[model samples]
Target chain A: GAGVSQTPSNKVTEKGKYVELRCDPISGHTALYWYRQSLGQGPEFLIYFQGTGAADDSGLPNDRFFAVRPEGSVSTLKIQRTERGDSAVYLCASSLWGTSTGELFFGEGSRLTVL
Target chain B: GESVGLHLPTLSVQEGDNSIINCAYSNSASDYFIWYKQESGKGPQFIIDIRSNMDKRQGQRVTVLLNKTVKHLSLQIAATQPGDSAVYFCAENGAESKLTFGKGITLSVRP
Candidate 1:
């Protein structure tokens, strides 16, 4: 893909339901990241991946939020037993390399509304 | 606990005027800082970035200034336009390649 791609642009799920958001990073990009943005706030870091390994997951918030990138290209963010407070836009980004100096290319984001 | 914050929550400027947005980060270890612009119903787009070694960097009609002594970062937009109306965010590269972002400042350009 020319840029980062995300699926399920919008999702409305009931409380306690499980939902998954997908992201397809640009070809040959080795670094992928996930972020969540609440209303009137900036994007918060959720997780970061270097290749197929999760280099960091400290910002996942809780045990209910999980993400995976098995192939080093596509990633998925899975939320279990979703709560109303979890309503936000989930964003995905990719970089040519997982370096601090590289700029991240962002996707359109998946808006999840937990009702 | 290191965190990033903005001095102002919102800023209103006239079109064609220069606009400046400020942000402060607590981490001194951060070596890179980036500014992003996010419009309604869209994701954040990269505006500009400055490295710790450089105090300033410039792009097309935009400039980013970094003050490592105070851990402050700022973005300047020249000749602001209506299209520049969006929420501006400052992010600092933290441990493990994570970018910690500030709350953001909403910039409104009035015609």
Candidate 2:
């Protein structure tokens, strides 16, 4: 796809279970980001990857949330011991540069529901 | 901690009228700001962006104004259309590469 693509558009899991969400950015994009959005709120920065390295993961709520962009193309966000509070829409975006100074192309996002 | 926030949760304007959405940021070091529009069940699309160096930037039917003195940002849509009805968010980028977004404001255009 010419745009960002995210898999598992909807994921419902029980509390304490683990989940993984995938994101495929536009070809040739060097920068990728992950954000979490709860109901009625905007996306909160989660992590940022420049190429194969995570330049910043300061936004990760805790050690349980982790993301990786291997080969600098496809990325995955992993969550462990999912809690009800973790239920939200996880959005992935990519840009040509590793900075927020430019426009970012975003995916449709993955909606996670914890029960 | 830095935070971005919108002035209001919702704004209603008549079709063909101009609409303005306001946002405020607590970080004084932010240098870049962006506005994004999100429709139902869709990801946010970029609208326009302004740097702290410039006070205003204009796009197709959209204008973004930034005030560094007060740390305020406003997005103006000329001649609001039904298609313009969506949730709008203002984001700020500081020294870090990541962007911090505020709670969005829902714009409703009434015909």
Tens-digit lDDT track of model 2 for A5-94: 998999999999999999999999999999999999999999999999999999899999999887999999999999999999999999
lDDT of 2 by residue, B1-111 (tens): 889999999999999999999999999989899999999888999999998899999999999999999999999999999999999999989757889899999999999
TM-score of each: 0.97, 0.98
The A-chain TM-scores of all the candidates are 0.98, 0.97
- Clashes by residue pair, model 2: none
lDDT of 1 by residue, B1-111 (tens): 999999999999999999999999999999989999999988889999888999999999999999989888999999999999999999988675899899999999999
lDDT (C-alpha, whole model) for all candidates: 0.93, 0.94
Q: TM-score: which candidate is best?
A: 2
Candidate 2 second chain TM? 0.98
Separately for all candidates shown, the number of backbone clashes (residues 3 or more apart, or on different chains) is: 0, 0
Q: iRMS values in order, in angstroms?
A: 1.1, 1.1
